[model samples]
Target: MIYKVLASILLLLVIIGGWSWTEYQSARNTLAVPGEQVSIDIKKGDSFDNITHKLIAQNVNIKPFWFKVVAMQEKATTKIKIGEYVLKGGMTAPELLAVLVSGKQKQYSITFPEGWAFKEILQEIAKNSYIEHTLTDSTIDFSALMAKLKVEKNHPEGLFFPDTYFFEKNTTDIAILKRAYDKMQVVLNEEWGKKEANLPLKSPYEALILASIVEKETGAKVERPLIAGVFTRRLEIGMLLQTDPTVIYGMGDNYQGNITLKDLRTPTTYNTYTIKGLPPTPIALPGRDAIVATLHPAAGDSLYFVARGDGSGTHVFSASLKDHNAAVNTHQRKAN
Candidate 1:
């Protein structure tokens, strides 16, 4: 009787092992495609069962039962990352499992251009599928996220380096912003280490502030240093920066092409015409070129510059207040 019982148990074990092996083989065949591409979107907070159902409903040619079994065996059912995946049409179960486990999903490139403010940046992020556009207002409440990240700042302006970032679709806007900020930290630290000694900047943060000003002063690719020099000189002499862009930024959405005397005299922290120093924070995102220009301004005592109004995106730098006024009159007042 004991022998009989032992034989029965051995037979059951063999049958169970064979069934498991067959199930795995079936899964591999179900997903095996050669060259076709299957685009799949995995949303955030999706469970294994839901993801299986989604795939089945999409006619992905993946067997739900076997896929679930394989996922469970590989401990990947709960681990499929949320993102857009470009699965090759004829890939096997193992291949799909490997891709999901390794988190090799489709990536979309999102670019943040230079001179964009936080609101613009957020808008750009919202326009991309990679981010959740929750804040529809002009001013985003960055305090909550900043506090969560333990960052001491209320806004991350110059802190986010402008670059083309690759992200999986359905990513949160905050996550993308954090990535930009992290990249900025790396770039800022590297550049700060190479800065010239005795710069008027008290810290890396100050350099970024000056860079932001330089970014707004000129759009000319090669004239960033001269613009930086203008601001740095004014800062050294305790002259009000007197930048019109700050005024424009202060006016926000209400700013038309016209700048009134009242606008310049507005009692705002960003009104460089009234403020003797840098604003409380950066006005826009400064590119690496602007950042470099801030650390190495052109050698000059000229304290003024004016737009040429030629629509060539260039400015004329002047040394004396009289020269600046003459250019302004000739280019701006007389022409307009």
Candidate 2:
């Protein structure tokens, strides 16, 4: 009877060893087709069981028992991060556990293009469903927002650097705004230190205001310095900027698709035709090139420009109003 009991015990040990080896191999095998990918969200306070269920629901061919065993072996059960994670098809159970423990969450992007206004930036932020919206309204309280960002300027316009910003899911809008704002400050200060001497700008803020105008004036990268030169010369000579964009900005909600003679004659803080110097604040978010162009305006005698109106988006530069009017007559008449 003792000999028979010993043989049965040996048989049970062999079976258990075989099962353990099988599970170990399974833990190392791919969980899905080689090139397949899946996304899963692990919320805060989620249990290890909950994560296993989530994986299974996403069609990942993972054996929960083996997965848990591997997690225990790696000591990753208490270390998995909470965020959106992308799992690859060829990833083994151990590899997935490593990724979760690393906290390398999926990144999403939001872009603020050059020449966009503050209102447009706010609207874009509001439209992003992945971001955590913390602001009270689309028309943000500028002073309060600036305080939150720790920015000295009360106006938010032209403060944010226009570029593609990346963040993990559920990042706050204010967090993104602060990043952009800080980036702009760094870039502006750097450029200001390198700016050419004798420019009309008194401070980096003035450069920003002029840069915003240059950005709104043209989309052509090559024309930016030329446009800056015109504005700078005007500022030096006490000539009216007469920029239509400022007039339109002043018109605000009242501005239609086009500006009128009445609009130019009417006075507002932003209307360059009526105002003597730069606007009370920046009118739009200028790109790096615009800021650079404003600081280092091209050397030229030309003081005025009109669109070529040939759909090339180029302009005609002139030194005298007579010549500018002639070009305007030629181009504007042709366009009409």
lDDT (0 to 1) per candidate? 0.81, 0.91
Candidate 1 residues lying further than 4 Å off, grouped into runs, are 1-31, 34-36, 42-83, 89-94, 127-130, 133-142
- TM-score of predicted model 2? 0.96
Model 1 agreement with the true structure over 1-336: per-residue lDDT tens digits: 999999999999999999978877888765554357766678888887777776666566667777877778788877788777877777777677767677788988898889988778777877776567655566556787687556788877677889999887666776777789988888887889998767789988999888888888777879999988888888888998999878888788979898999998887878999888998888899988899999988888889988888887788889899999999988878658
Worst 10 residues of 2 by lDDT: 27-36
lDDT digits (tens) for residues 9-43 of candidate 2: 99999999999988788776756424578888999
Model 2 / residue 117 / CA error / Å = 0.7
